[model samples]
Each structure stands twice: as structure tokens, then as C-alpha cells.
Target chain A: MLEIQNVSVRYGRHQALFDIAAQVERGKITVLLGTNGAGKSTFLKALGGLVPTGPGASIKLGGVEIAAIPAHRRVEAGLALVPEGRGIFGKLSVAENLHLGGFAHRARTDEKERLERVLDLFPRLRERMPQIARTMSGGEQQMVAMGRAMMSHPDFLLLDEPSLGLSPLLSKDMFKSLRRIASEADVGILLVEQNAKLSLEIADYGYLLENGHIVGQGPAEELRSSPAVLRAYLGEEVVPA
Target chain B: MTILVTGILLGGTYALIALGLTLQYGVARIMNLSNGETLVAACFSAWLLFTTTGINPLWGLLIIAPLGFVANGAIYLGLLRPLVRRATSQGMLEVDSILATFGLLFLFEGLMHLGFGGAYFNYQFLAVPFKFLGGSYALNRITAFGAAAAIALALYLFLYKTRMGTAVRAVAVDPEAARLVAIDVGLIAAFAFGLGGAITACGGVLLSTFYTFNASMGAVFTMKALIIVIMGGVGDVRGAVIAALILGVMETLVASLIDPGLTLAATYGLFVLILLFRPQGLFGGAAG
Candidate 1:
């Protein structure tokens, strides 16, 4: 399990996140939903240790406090983040990118098996391994990002806007893969997303953030029919059938 | 044809020198002004090894190359790291690094003067001249060119075929992205600085046998490297080699056909022309 407590982020003077707390269970998908300026991205960065939090903030992964860990060490701590914009090394070949994904545990003997599992999960990457990442299509690049993270064999994966810039069909496929990865791979997934309808369909739990505050939280099915969720997300005309 | 051949041979050393500068600029956005000092220091070390112990100058590579590598890493860790950490923008980093290295350039010159005195020293080793393809060439030039070509090939293989090499390229392409993938970006940059230093030292070792050098000669080599790097585009390794060849051939032609005194003037004139028309350089990549 991954737990974030009292997390607040400040960029110089302006605060981005204010004492936000969240958690994701092992082998389950937790979807974070919010409109623009809701601090979803900042919260994700705090978990990844890319952004610093306030004095009282703490992050625990598998019973270990990881708040003080540097961003590069977070991967070795069984926490990997697929940051916003995919964060792929655009100039490197896909194979090289995947090779670097295993860098955290490069000394481990099971590295070859880990890579084989990642390739099996995203077979598309296996075919495009030799091509430079920048030249790939947006959907393919997204796969590369996810595949790269999986190459690290993380216990918990944090994804920020994974469905961004993908077509509806591609987004659905991506969400399906995320679902499969969370269940079959036994990895906790904390996904920050904008596609509420599709995200809730696969999420086991849901948190609604507003103005950097968690305004609502519940099971996926309960949140799907909530009046506030309906009004803000699914709208009055459509109510998840 | 002879001028072209001579120029091409000399160009190999230029390319090796500029390649290090280009990597430092391209990956870290640092304008390492003391690059030439590193070459000169390596040459001096080689000179000391040969003159004191009566050993072959070529044998100095076993000693000078590793020292140069460590020296570059020390320069990065001691002088440049803090500046890069405090930098808020790439432009600010470039300015700060250039100014810092300018100070370093003088520091190295002073050290060289204190260590070796201010006299011109030429390595008398490899004095044999050889005949090749209707042209008589000195053995030193051929060896220097061969060593440079081999270094270039080795660098290419390292960047393309090795994991650590890919990590370096990944950081060069996008540092933040490299960090997310679990690459220790700081460590990679330092390693690159060390590798760059080692390569330039190899060029210096080759150069000592062919040319006369003193403590102050570092600044001239530094200027030539800057000209080649600017002509090739900032951080473009392959482009630096091509630009080095162009400069070498052009300088040789000017020296042989016109006047040896006009070589520097012609080189700078060409540099001014390139800046006026194509500031991004002939290869056109990020000048940063």
C-alpha cells in the first residue's frame, strides 16, 4: 500500500497542493479525478519525489517512509512514476530506453526476465524496439512510457494524464492495459486522469479533488452514481446507463 | 592535393579536440573555456614523462589519459557543479560556466608556467618521415591522425552499442526525461566530462609529437576549438568533425597558396561569415 499524508507543495510563494492525503491499495486501481488547477499533477510529483513537500508531509510505500528519498532512488524503492507528457527519452532508440528502465536494478540477475515480462505486456514495443522514441506515434509513445516503467518492476506505479492526446479508441485500449497491469501484475496503480467515465469504469476506488482539496471519495460504483459526480462529470442527460 | 592531404590530417586532431567541447556544451550547456588548457596540461605531462625518464612519448598515454579524465571530473565536481545547481535557466548556466572556465583557463596557465617554465618545448620523438600516395608525410602526423580516427570510431561505438553510452546520449537529449527513467543524471554528466577530458588528452598526446607548445599555447588551441564548435553547431559531435575538416583544409590552402601569416585571419574571417549568415551553424542544432 502507498499512503500520502499532509502533502502540500509550494512553488516559491504560490501553493499548488494543500495538505492533501491519498492512498492506493495493492493490486487495485485508484483514480484521481479533477478539473484544471486541481493539483493532481503536483500530488503525483510529490509522490515521485520530483517536487518537495511541506515539513509535515510524509509518503509511505510498503511501510517505509519515502518522502526524503530522491527522485532517482524512488524507482529502486518499488515506486515508479510515468510523469506527464510521457517523459520518454525522445532521441534514444526504444530498446535503449527500455534498457535504461532496468538501470535502477541493473546489477540484479533477474533483469533479463523482467525485460521479457515487460515486452510480453506491451508487444508493440518489441516490434518498435529499434526505432527512435521521438518518431513514434503518440499512442505508441504512451505505450513506451508504460512499458519503460514496468521494466523497473515497481510495486506501485503513479501515472499522470496517461490518456492525454490519445484518440478515444486508443484511450480505451490504454485504460484496458492499465487495468490488466494492476490486476495481473499485482501492482498498485495510482492514476490521475481526466476521462472520468472510462477511468471510473476500471477504477476500484475514486477520489474527486477540487481546488487542491479532496471533496469526495468512495467506491467506483458509488461515485459513478453520486449526484455531484453526475452533475460535474457524466452530466444530467447521461448517468452511466 | 598535398595541401588537402595535409589539412585533412591536421583536421583529425581538431575534430578530437572540438568533440569534447561539443559534448560538454551539448549535454550540460557549459562553455568550457579551459578545454585547451587540459590538452596543454596533458601534452606537458607527456613531455615530462619522455624527457625525464627517456621513455617513449606514446607510452605517456597510459599515464596522461587517465589523469586528464580524473582532472576533468574534478573540474566539474569542484567548479561547475555548484554553478549548474544554482542556475535557473540554460542561458544563465552558459554565461556562468563560460565565465568560470575563463578563470580556470588562467589558473591552468599559471600552474603550467610554475611547473614547466615559459619555454617552447617540442617532442623530438617520432622524427621519421614517410612517403605515401605521391606525398612525403611525417610519421607524427600519420600517427596523430590514426589515433584521432580510432578515438572517433571508439566513441561512436560506445554511444551506440553500450548501455552506459545510451544513458549518456539519453541525458544529452533530455535530462529530466533521463531522470524519470532512473538514470542518475548528475553522475552521467560527470562521467561524460571525464570521457571528454580523456579524449582531448589523447589528442594532446598525438599533437605534442607534431607541434611545438608552451604554457600560453593553450589559449590558441582553445580559440581554435571554439571556432570549430561554433562552426559545427553547439553540442553536435559529428558536425564538429566535419567543421574541423573544413577549417583544416581551408587553413592549409590559405597558408600554402596565399601566406602563412594570413591563416588565422582567414579562419576568423570564415568564422565571421558563418556567424553572419548561419548562426545555428552548418549542421543547425541547438547552439546551447
Candidate 2:
């Protein structure tokens, strides 16, 4: 399990995240839902160590404290982040990007097996290996980003807005793939997304964030059926009286 | 035919020199103005080794290249790493690195002037003329060109084939993304800066075999290298090689056909044309 506690982030004087606590279990999908500027990205970045967390914050991966490590070192410790903008090396070929994904010391021993698994997860990438990542379609690039992250053989994967810029149909397919990846790879997924309905549909647990604070948390089924979630994020219709 | 051969030989050396600057700027994010001073230092080292210890410049490369690596690595760690750490953005880093390396340029030049006493230095090593394509050329020039080509080829293979080298290129493409893949961006940048220095110093050793150089002339090579780097595209290895060849041929043609004094003029002419027209470089897409 990956546990996050007392995680707070600040950029200069602006606090992006407050004291947040969350837990993500292996082989499960945990979704974080929030509106824009709700500190969803900041929360994910802090978990990945891309942003500095406040003192006393704790990020534990498989019972090991990892919050103090640098971003790259966090990857070596079996934590990978697919940040916003897809974070794939755009100028490099898909093959090279995937190759680099296995650069962590932990992943090097089984890099070949990981490559095979990644290709199985995103078959489209197998054909586009030689193409530059930036030239691919938005959905395809998302696949590359996810595929690249999987290449690290991460114990925990943090994804920010994985469905952004992807077609609705593609987003559905992406969520399906995420379900498969979590179950088959036995990797914990900490997902931050704006598409509340679809994300809750695939998630095992859910956290609702507002103004950098976790306003509510529950099982995915409960959150999906909750009145507040439906009105705030699902855009429930209001009929005339 | 002779002109073409000579230009190509010259271009080989120029390509090697420009490549170092490209790596330093592209991967390390440093616009190192002192790049040519390392080259000059290598040149003087080659001269001193040959004159005193009777070591061939080709053999002197073994000593000077590694020294270049250590020296450049020290500079990056001791001087530029702080700038990199404190820089808030790419533009700020560029400004800071340019200023810092600009200062380094003068410091190195002054030290070389003191050490070598501001005199043109050259040595006769393999000065025999070798016939090629119905024209005669200096054996040292051919040898220098051959060495440069070999080094460039090795660098190309290292970048394209090896895992560590690919990591370097990955950092060059996107440092933030590289971090996601577990690449140590800081370590890679330092290595690249050091390797770039080594390559540029190698170019200097090769040139010292045939060309006359003085301590103060480092700035001229720096400008020429900068022109080639800009003309090719920042961080584009293939483009730099092509641009350097074009520059060599053009400079040779201008010097031989028009006037010897107009070579620098022609170089600037091409620079202005590149900046005015294809500022993104000959092969690069629209500037981001």
C-alpha cells in the first residue's frame, strides 16, 4: 500500500494543498476528483516528489518513507508519475521513451518483460515505436505516457488528468486499460481526474478534494451514488417545479 | 576538387568543435562562452607537450582530453551548478550561464596569455602532402579530419546505441520527463558538460597539428562555433555536422575566390541570413 499523510504544498505564499491524507492499495484504483485549481495536480506532484511537501508530511511506498527523496530517486523506489502534459519525451521516438522508462535500477533486471507487458497493454505503441511521440494523436500520446510509466515497473503510479484532451470514446478505452493494468500488474494507481463519473465507475475508492482539502472520502460505489457528488460533479439535471 | 577537399577537411574539425557547444547548451542548458578557451588550452597543451616532451599531438590527446573532462566537470560543479540551482526558469538560466561563462572566457584567455606569452604557436607533425583526387593536401589535415570524423561517429553511436548515452539525450529532450523515468538530470548534465569539454579539447588537439594558434584567438573559434550551432539548430547533431561542412566550404570558397579577408564577412553574412530567415535553424520546425 502507498500511504500519504499530512501532505501539504505551497508555491511561494500560495498554499496549493492542505493537510491531506489518503491510502492507495496495490492492485486497486483510487481516484481523486476535484474541480480546476482544487490542488489535484499539486497533490499528485507532491506524492511524486516533484513538488516540495510541507514538513511532517509522510509518503510511504510499501512501508518505506519516500517523501524526502528527489523526484528521480522516487522513481527508483518504485514510484512513477505520469504528470500533466503526458510528461513523455516528445522529441524522442516511442521506442526510446519506453526504453528510458526502464532506466530505474529496480526495473533494469526485468526490463524486457516489462517492455512486453507494456506493449501488450498498449498495442498501438508497438506499431508506432519509431515515430516521435509528439507527432502521435492525443490519445496515442496518452498511451505512450502510460506505457512509459509502466516501463518503470512502478509499485505505485500517479496519473494527473489522463483523460484530458482525449476523445470521450478514447477516454473510456483508457479507463478500461487502467483497470486491466491495475489488476494484472498489481500496481497501485492514484488517479486525479476531472471526469468524475467515468473515474468513479472504475475506481475502488474515491476522495473528493475542494480548495486543497479532502472534503469527503468513501468507497467508489458510495461516492457514485452520493447526492453531493452527483450535484457538484456529475451535473445532475434540475427540473422545473 | 582541391578546394572541396580542403574545405571538407576544415569542416570535419569545425563539426567536432560545434558539437561540444551543442551538447553543453542542449543537455546541460548552458550557453558556454568559454567553450573555445578549452580548445585553446588543449592547443597550447599539445604545443607544450610536443615542444618539451616530444609527444605527438595525436598522443597528447589522451592526456589533454581527460584533463579537459575533469576541468570542465569542476567548472560545472563548482561554478555553474549553483546558477542552475538558483535559476527560476530557462531564460534566467540562459542569462546566468552566458554571463558566468563569459567571465570564464576572459579568465581562461588571460591565463593562457600569461602562460603562453601571446605568441603564435605551430609545429610540424606529418606536414607531408598527400595526393587526393588530382590535388595535394597536407597529411596532418587529412589525419585531423579523419580523427574528427571518428570521434563524431563514436559520439553518434554512443548517443544512439548505448543506454547511458540515450539517457543523456533523454535529458536533453526533456529534463522533467527524464526525471519521471528515474534519470538523474543533474548528474547527466554534469557528465555532458564534461564530455563536451573533452570533445572540444580533442578538436583543438587535432587543429594544433596543422594550424597556427595563439592564446587570444580563442574568441574567433568561439564565434565560428556559435555561428555553426545557430545555423544548424541548437541540439541537433546531424544539423550541426551539415552546417559546419557548409560553413567550411563557403568560407574556403570566399577566401580563395573573392578575398582572404572576406571570410569572416562571409561567415557573418550567412549568420545574418540564417537569423533573418530560418531562425529556427535549417531543419528545425517553427520556434516554440
Candidate 3:
């Protein structure tokens, strides 16, 4: 489980995020919904220790404070961020990319077994294990990114916009797989998504962010049917009774 | 025809030097203007060992290479790395890298001048020209080409096949992503700098034997190295070999068709043309 308390971020004169607080349940998919420039990615980055936070910002991973930890050290302590843009090395093969994920830990004997688990999650990867990752399609690359993150076997997986460029069907399949992964692996997930409806459908708990503030938080179904949420995202102009 | 064979042979030597530059540029993300300087430095060290101990140039490499690795790593950390980290402009990074290394080159040349007294020097070769392809062509190398080839192949294999090699390549692609997986990108950079230095051993030895070399010799030879690296395609080692061979053959042909004085000019011209057109180098599809 992860708890972020009053996190804030500033880039010189620009305040990117202001007072973002969210709780993520272990073994559950927690989705954060926000418009563009709403600082969803920045919030996730703050948790991963990639973004510097203000004095009041506090990130707790499994109840341990990671305020002082560096990004890489945070990863070493089981916080893995599969950043946006798939970040998978196109020049490297799928196997090498996944293998390198387990490089830092001492108990990295899980390569063969974890690889098998990854193949089960996305079997297409096993067939193309030796092929160059850049040669794979976007959806497949996303799967590779997720699989690569999974190789770390992190207790907390922070997926930043995993469904950004996928087709609608592919996005559906991705969310379905993400839900399954959280259930099967029994790991905590903090997902930032642009697709509000699809995200709330799969998420156990959801937070709606607008203008860098936590504008909404509750059970997924509650927020999904809210009229204001509908008007903001759906732009339907009128909410159904 | 003899000029052709010689040109190709020189190209082979040029390729080894370019291969070092490729790794520095393609993987390490450092412009590494000091590469040729370091190779020249290696040549001087080998020359010193040969002059003092009367060691065979080939055998002296085993000692000289490790020294080059340490020296290069030190230069990268002490000189270039800090400049790169502090630089805000791309032009500043490239300019500072180029000027600083060239300055280092002059400093190194000054030291070599003081040490060797700038007198023309050659590390006597055990070199014997052997015929290949039924004596139609001469490899003109006594283990130097073989050694260079072996080192290049070893580097290619280590980078593509090994775990650590992939990590280095990953760092080249996205340092941030590499760090996320917990690779100490800084350590990877140091290792890359070391590997780049280690691989330059044969080029220095061959330069010492096959031609007249002084501390300043690296200046001209390094240009040939740059041409080869560019022709081969920036980061691709395989491209480096092909470009080297082509430039070698080209230089040889130029000498035969025009004049020996024009060989260096021909190389420089070809480099300009390639920069204007391809800009990527020969095997350039291998970005990162």
C-alpha cells in the first residue's frame, strides 16, 4: 500500500502540482483521472522520487517514508516506475530488457521463473523474445514495458499512462490485463489514465484530478455516474436522470 | 594496385580508432574529442616501453591498454563529465567537449614533445606482410589487423550478447530508464569510457609500426579515424568496419590516381560530403 500526504511540486516559477493526496490499496488497481496538465504524471513521479517535492510532501511506500530516497534507490527498495512513452530499449531484445530489470537486486534468481510469469501475462512477448523491441507494435511495446516493470517484482508498480497510445480495443484489453495482474500478482498498482470511463471501470478506488488538485475521490461506480464528472469528461451538456 | 592494398590496410587501422569514437558518441553520450589524443597518448606510452625495455610492440600492448583505460576514465570523469553535466546548451556541450579535448591534445602533445624531444620515432615492427586471396591482395599486417578485428568482434559480442553489455546499451538509449532498473548509470558511463579506451590498444600499436608517429601523429590519423567512423555510420561498429574499408580503398585509389599529397585531402573531402548528405554514418540505422 502507498500513501501520499499533501505532496506539492514546483518547476522554478511554475507550480506543476499542488496538494495531491491519494491512498492506494494493496493488491488493487487505484486509478487517478485528470485532464491534460492536471499533474497526474507529476504526482506519480513524485511517488517514484523522480520529481523533487516541497517540504510538506510525504510519500510512504508500505508505511516506510521514502522522502529522502533517490529515484534509483527507491527502485531498489521495490518502487518501479514504467514511465510514459514505453521507455523500453528499442535496440535491445525483449529478453534483455526484462533481464536488466532484475539486475540490481541480490535475489535475482527469479529471471527464468518471472519471465515465465510475464509470458503468461502476455504470451506474444515469448514468441518475440529474441526480436528487437522496436520492431514490435505499440500495444506489444506497452506489454513489454509492463512486463519489464513486472520483472523487478516490485511491491508497488507505478504505471504512468500505460494506455496512452493504444487503440480503444487494445486499451480495453490493457485495462482488463492490468486488473488481472493486480488480482493474480497481489501487488499494489497506482495507474494514471486519460480515459476516465475505462479507468473507473477497472479501478477499485479512483481519484479525479483537475487543475493539480484532488477534485474528487471515492468508489469507482460513484464517480462514474456523477453528473459533474459526466459534464467535465463526456461533454454531453446534460446528465441522464 | 599496391596503393589500393595499402589504402585498405590503412583503413583497417582507421576503423579501430573510429570504433572507439563510435562507442563514446553512440553509447556514452559524450562527444569525446579527446579520443584521438588518448590513442596518441597510448602510442607514446607503448613507444616509451619499447624504447626503455626493448619489448616487442605487440607484447607491449597488454601493458599499454590497461594504462589507456585508466587514463581515459580519469579524463572522462575529471574533464568531460563535469562539463557535460553543467552545460545547458547543446552547442556549449559540443563546443566545450571539442575544445577541451583538443586542448588536452595540445597539452598531451606538449608532454610527448618534452618526453621524446619530438624526434621522428618508430617502434620497430615484427611486421611481415602476408598475402591473402591467392596473393592477389596483401593483408600487409602481422597480427595487428587480426588483433584489431578480434578486439572489435569481442566488443560487439560483449555489447550484444552479455548482460552487462545490454545494460550499457540501455544506458545509452535512456539513462533514466536504465536507472529505473537500478543500473548505476554513472558506473556504466565509467565502464563505457574504460571499454572505449581498452579497445584502442591495437590501433595505437599498428600506428606506431606501419607509419611514422609522434605525439602529433594522432592529429592526422584521428581525422582518418573520424572519416572512417562517419562513413561506417555513427554508432554501429559493423558500420565502422565497412566505412573504414571503403575509406581505406578510397584513400589508396586517390593516391594512385592523383598524388600522395592528396590522400589526406581526399579523406577530408569525403568526410565533408558524408556530413552534408548522410550525416548519420554508414551503419546509422542502429540509433543508440
All DockQ scores? 0.74, 0.89, 0.74
Candidate 3 local lDDT, residue B49: 78
lDDT of 3 by residue, B1-288 (tens): 566666666766777888877777666677666677777777777777788988877787788878877887887888878987888775787788888878877787788777777667765565454676444343335356667777778888998888888888888877778878878777788778777776665578766766677766667766777777777766677888888888888978988888989988988999899989887765576433
Interface root-mean-square deviation, each candidate: 1.0, 0.6, 1.2
lDDT score of residue B284 within candidate 1: 78
TM-scores of the first chain across all predictions?
Answer: 0.95, 0.97, 0.94
TM-score quality measure for candidate 1: 0.95
**What tens-digit string does per-residue lDDT give for candidate 2 at A135-183?**
9999999999999999998989999999999889999999999999999
- lDDT string for model 3 (A1-241, tens) is 7888989999898998887888887789898888899998888878877779988878888888887787777877778888878678887888888888777683287678888888998989889888889998999999999998888888888898888889999999899888888888887899998888888889888888888899888888887888777778656535465
- Tens-place lDDT per residue, model 2, B1-288, is 788889999999999999999999999999999999999999999999999999988889899999999999899999999999999999999999999999999999999988888889999999999988899999999999999999999999999998899999999988988999999999999999999999999999999999999999888899889989998899989989999999999999999999989999999999999999989899888653
Give me the runs in candidate 2 sitting further than 4 Å from their true place. Answer: A237-241
C-alpha local distance difference test of each model:
0.87, 0.93, 0.79
Model 3, runs deviating above 4 Å: A225-228, A234-239, B1-5, B89-91, B129-140, B285-288
Task: Identify the CAPRI category of the predicted complex in candidate 1.
Answer: medium
Query: In candidate 2, which residue pairs clash?
Result: none
- Give the winner by TM-score: 2
User: What is the two-chain DockQ of model 3?
Assistant: 0.74
Residue pairs clashing in model 3 are B232-B239, B232-B282, B233-B281, B233-B282
The C-alpha RMSD in Å for every predicted model, in order, reads: 2.0, 1.4, 2.6
lDDT of 2 at A191: 96
RMSD of 3: 2.6
lDDT of residue B195 for candidate 3: 72
Better by lDDT, candidate 2 or 1: 2
